[model samples]
Target: MERGLTGRYEVTRTAEEAVRAFVPNPLPPEPPLDLSGERQRLLEQALLACGRLDGVSALLPDPDLFLYAYVRREAVLSSQIEGTQSSLSDLLLFELDEAPGVPFDDVVEVSNYVAALEHGMNRLREGFPISNRLLREMHEKLLARGRGVDKLPGEFRQTQNWIGGTRPGNAHYVPPPPADLADCMASLERFIHSDPKPFPDLINAALTHVQFETIHPFLDGNGRVGRLLIALMLHDAKVLRQPLLYLSLYFKQHRAEYYRLLDRVRQEGDWEAWLEFFLEGVTQTAGGAVETAHRLLALFQEDRNRLQDLGRSAANTLRIFNALCSRPIATIRDLEATTGVSYPTASKAIETLSELGIVRELTGRQRDRVYAYDRYLALLNEGTEPL
Candidate 1:
């Protein structure tokens, strides 16, 4: 299965230095993927996991509550891979207009990711094609604020870029130079449109992700954007009702191996190895998401049942509890606004929940107190212990 070099490299001169910039061949590599035996088994497992995840979403009373929090968790983890130090809690705190203890720039990066992802998924749901234009739109939102603002946010890079080194001289890999971008990107666009032949959705996504990484279209946020493309493709193909299958956690956990496999595809024509890894990631990530959704659903039901024991306070207590299910952490003011109840009423309800050990107060203060849904947050915070 070793077909070799996958694509040709161009000898380009940048800043009085010569470098070999890789221009990857388009999708549906010659001699097709070897989907026999183990590879076929992995593909089947991934499809089954995705099917199970889809079932979970369909059965949920409100999938958006899970989607809302899950997407933000992905944003935090995806940006973490790009060296951002923000955590999922930090993102929630930031969304609530509270200061996240992390650096302002780091939180902004994660926040932008959330916005960018939402934009892409919304556009796709509206019947927009996943082409270069949509990617540009996503890139615009991704670097809309903070550190990446100066990195030519929406447009493809017009200058040479390198990865893993100070300059092209010692860079780990140099992407296609500026002059070759148009042809390179156009070929990529055709592949995305499934010009000649169409691969299955999961296989198409795996191929597209690697090609985008090699293309490294934007000046910055290539890695983040490439990862986003996976969710977008899956959703577009109707593989999942919600954008719930994120592989960033798996990729981040296996960081070194992930990069190595990507390189292996380019250097050696080892698509089978990378495909195997990707399938495993998809299966593991999808199964994990299904488990988390079920656990969260069960926890919410159990806690709601427990709240029913609040007797006279049960009616008002249930209202606040529902708000916490959506926002896991809330201040009295948050519950008040969300539940449309008065301040004193919200406070008493929170006090009742706290007494019942349903909600835990985080800040030890007499005023401006904040409360967390305790076990609910614990379930979401699993595997998200920050980098």
Candidate 2:
């Protein structure tokens, strides 16, 4: 049902032109979401997928190994939507201080994404609530050392900001003017912390994500932070044990439709359409994550079997293989530190793996060479091409 224009637009003057900036209403869309028939089925599937995704940790001997790469994969995909060009390998190489020709700023943005997500997860584990304060903290880490550093990292925008065009006059969307931010954000927080709980966890997350994006609270990292809010909210609400569900790939894949639905919710008051898309993304992404965990577990076991035949050299070689499982890209020194072996032992293990074709050298250089677990990365690199 089209409820028509979800919020009022306020006329605001900017440097070059005047525009009607949108200030969105708070959560629990008026008239309530119609979650009765097919919508109910979608929500049930999404929640069930999340339940399986939450228990996917059981599929791995060490879930962090998958989490480590999976999170970076998400960072790359998320940043790519904002026009960053860094790949998963580029990020891993950057963390090792060995990405000689990789785009520095792009990789920094992806790395900061990893750090920001970890910070948010850590804060949640320490009993912090998801509020404006924590969102600011995550935004701070996200822009700590990227192109947006000058855009005021940890604070909400104090000036008008628009999306898509050269100026607010012709922009695709203009978020709320600065003056409305405090009240808007506080209302959003209240919705999140409502005593009776306005909606179920999955529904609440969908509503919160849209409201936060409409608010567009931050100066530079709103898109990234808004995407992060979904994962954070799901994890905080006990929908998932690990902060693993990311819709960036889904949004990136269906870029046009995603934007259209967000606009529809604002203009036609079609919350049901947006919620349908959001639930589908959750179901697809969560199920995909579980499938990935299974594939990785199988890959690890297959690779271990391949190495078990190495006999005398298998001991040290398997140790390095374990390290590679956690980090698919590593230098000799990185493996050494991770495996607690001497430089020579790590180097020889690398040499043996090189001969076996289990790992390949990234750089042909005699020194500062990097190696990659090619097949493992191949799995994570799916659908991560820059948009």
Task: Give the alpha-carbon lDDT of every model.
Answer: 0.90, 0.91
Ten residues in a row with the worst lDDT in model 1? 191-200
Candidate 1 lDDT over 1-387, as tens digits, reads: 787998899998888999999988877788788899998899999999999999999999998999988998899899999999998778887887878889999999999999999999989878999989899999999999999999999999999999999999789999998988888888887887875447778998999999999999899999999999999999988888788999999999999999999899998888889999999999999999999999998898988898887678789989989999999888999899999989998999998888889899777889888788889877877887677
lDDT of 2 by residue, 64-123 (tens): 888888899999999999999999988888888876355789999999999999999999
TM-score of each: 0.97, 0.98
The clash number for model 2 is: 0
**Model 2 score (lDDT):** 0.91
**Candidate 1: segments with Cα more than 4 A from true spot:** 195-197
Candidate 1's TM-score? 0.97
Identify the candidate with maximal lDDT.
2
Tell me how far the alpha carbon of residue 294 in candidate 1 is from the true structure, in angstroms, after superposition: 1.2
Give Cα distance to truth, residue 261, candidate 2, Å: 0.4
The local lDDT score (0 to 100) that residue 382 gets in candidate 1 is 80
